[model samples]
Target: MSNISKKNKGYFSEEIVKNYYINNGFKFIEQNFTVKGGELDLIFSKVGSLKFIEVKNIDGINDLFDYITKKKLNFLIKTINIYLYKFDITNIDYSLDVVFVKKNEIYEIYDNIGI
Candidate 1:
């Protein structure tokens, strides 16, 4: 796929995940949140806890954990730190989450492998 097509697919997938979260009672904070060296696909909150979510759209991929690299995990951590620092948020509970999308099916893995 071309770069543009890939981007469009990613955007659509993110939107799908975002809507799913919203429907499930998570309030959306941001989408495509970017910092200096990394980007977070979605940020949401439920109750008083914050969630930094990374979304992946795949076709026929069985191993979802394979998509998250160490480098990507580090980048996400740094990005979340920056977001908290920039917003001066402290003492708030937070966790990293992953959302996997395959066609109309959506699955969420919460605080599983990476933090």
Candidate 2:
């Protein structure tokens, strides 16, 4: 696929994930949050807990677990730390979550693959 097509697919997947979270009662804080180190796909809050979510849209080529590499997780952690420090957020519960999108199916794994 071309770069444009890949970008569009990413945006579409993000939109779907955003809507799914909203429908499930999570309040949206930001999307496509970028820092100097890395980018976070979505940020949301629910019941006083903040969630830094990474949305992965799988095209059946690789397993979901394969996407959460050590380097990627480290980058994500750094990004989240930057976000928190930038916003002066302290003492609030937070977690890093991964949302896997497979067509119409969605699954979320929270605070497991990422710290």
Candidate 3:
């Protein structure tokens, strides 16, 4: 698919995952939080724990790792830092999580896939 088509699919998947989290009692904080080099697909909070989520629309399990590369992880960390500083969030406890969506269903939810 083209970039636009792929992006639209990604957005749709993000929405699906957003609702999935909300249904599970997580409060939505933000979506599509973007900086120069990367974007946070979703931000959520529950019981004082904050989560920075990356959403992927995948066709197979292997496709999920394609999104988790060294460069991408570094960029994601930098983006999270920028988000925390810009929003003045300090020492609040956070994690980097990934949610994989296939079509309209959630394929898998992985928490704290850190490098």
Candidate 4:
């Protein structure tokens, strides 16, 4: 991972997160969904609840939460709204989450992390 490119490191990190969620019974929905102003790293659905995940490859970061800045959360909110409108998702449970990965390990997960 140390030698891998930044882009590949992100993809690798997402795969780890994806498998973890799938193993936990969440169906994989989408990844790297991008719009003009934002991007969603991963999406999942479980029992009518839509889960939006923001993944950060914190290879050398000290604090996991620091990666999720206010600006980033705003972008995520805007992107999720667009996603719901685009897919016509209504009357469903949804939440935002963040997953931090470091050295091929899942460091921490923050759920319902809305501002």
Using TM-score as the measure, which candidate wins? Answer: 4
Tens digits of per-residue lDDT for model 3, 1-115: 4455887888899999999889999999999999899999999998877889998787766656776888888998999999989989887888999888886799888788782
lDDT of 3 at 51: 89
Task: Give the Cα error of residue 114 in candidate 1, in Å.
Answer: 2.1
Worst lDDT run of 10 residues, candidate 1, spans 104-113
Give me the displacement of residue 39 in model 3, in angstroms: 0.5
State, as a TM-score between 0 and 1, how close model 4 is to the true structure.
0.94
Q: Please list the residue runs of candidate 2 whose C-alpha ends up more than 4 Å from where it truly belongs after superposition.
A: 1-4, 104-112
Scanning candidate 3 in windows of ten residues, the lowest lDDT window is 58-67
Candidate 1 lDDT over residue span 37-94, tens digit each: 9999999999898999898887777677779888889999999999999999999989
Local distance difference test scores for all models: 0.85, 0.83, 0.87, 0.92
Worst 10 residues of 2 by lDDT: 104-113
Please give the RMSD of candidate 1 to the true structure: 2.2
Per-residue alpha-carbon lDDT of candidate 4 for residues 69-99, written as tens digits (9 for 90 to 100): 8898999999999999999999999999899
TM-score of each: 0.89, 0.87, 0.89, 0.94
Which numbered prediction scores highest in lDDT against the true structure? 4
Model 3, runs deviating above 4 Å: 1-4
